[model samples]
Target: MFQPLAELPPPALGEREWLLECHCARPVTDLLKAQGWDVVADLDCNVHCSSPDRRVYVGLLPESQEAARGELWHIHVTDNSGTRTWRQTFGADTPAQAIAGFLAALIAFPARYCTCA
Candidate 1:
């Protein structure tokens, strides 16, 4: 059985969990997977989305599931891009704190040579 690890606490008001990443940072994705996050699906981030870049991501499944109803998340990182985006599912009380932490870590660049836009 897989166990959930201590992570960026759930957003203060939502149902999503967030973690930031940067071009040079080693994403905690593997760590999450080790805990319980499963890659349920692959994604084409550039397909019909406002994002101009392309990326391959794996969908994350939460530790909890209610009749197959749960949240999904995706993460991707590129070197020298200076930016990383975290797409997650949030409910009425979005995990704003965790999300903010994720944003802070995701946007932190070596020298401000990247962006999400």
Candidate 2:
């Protein structure tokens, strides 16, 4: 059987300034917000979602001219009070995949973060 956390509302259009070649910020933030998370999009195009002492951040790294020459997405989670942090990067071709990876990471390490109010 399958169960959802909540009956989330549909995401609003043009609500946040999404990056041009984004692979992980916009949709992830929208999902987070729908799940009752406090999310913010920053000037650097990073989406930050937090709950109490736990924080999750998603950022996009476009194809560059340097050595790391590919499009990448980074997701990080930090538990301020627990003094722990987890970060992972993925060579994702889409924003939804990157967000799914990040969510999977969080699910794999739930004790490392705070989920309270």
Candidate 3:
């Protein structure tokens, strides 16, 4: 059984629950999967999703330099030539619902246009 971080109450001080909150990726991954994206998780449990020209990552390690400082969500779109066209990141304390809101907007956005433009 998978439990989403959004449904959990706030963690108590020093609980260290945040360390294991990678489950926060579930809703985001599910959303991408339902939208015909390919979803996969690495051995470390980081979730990656990809469409034809876009990619999304959830629960990336804080130690990863590619990840924003302490960020859990990383999303990007690429051109047909594989150049990055758009990108966004959200920090560790960001709620799953908030990440979902951003992802929903991205998914709803037309792929033929550049959101960054």
lDDT of each: 0.37, 0.56, 0.66
Clashing pairs in 3: none
Name the weakest run of 10 consecutive residues (lDDT summed) in model 1.
44-53
Query: lDDT of candidate 3?
Result: 0.66
Query: Which is better, 2 or 3, measured by TM-score?
Result: 3
Give all candidate RMSDs, comma-separated: 16.5, 10.4, 8.3
**Could you tell me the TM-score of candidate 1?**
0.24
Residue 44 displacement in candidate 2 (angstroms):
3.9
lDDT of 1: 0.37
Q: What ranges in model 1 sit over 4 Å off?
A: 1-71, 80-94, 111-117
For residues 1-117, could you state the per-residue lDDT of candidate 1 as single tens digits? 554666545556576644333321123343333434332223532111111233323333333352146343334554445455444443313343443345346434434355555
Model 3 lowest lDDT segment of ten: 52-61
Better-scoring candidate (lDDT), 1 or 3: 3
lDDT winner between candidates 1 and 2 = 2
Candidate ranking under lDDT, highest first, comes to 3, 2, 1
Ranking by TM-score: 3, 2, 1
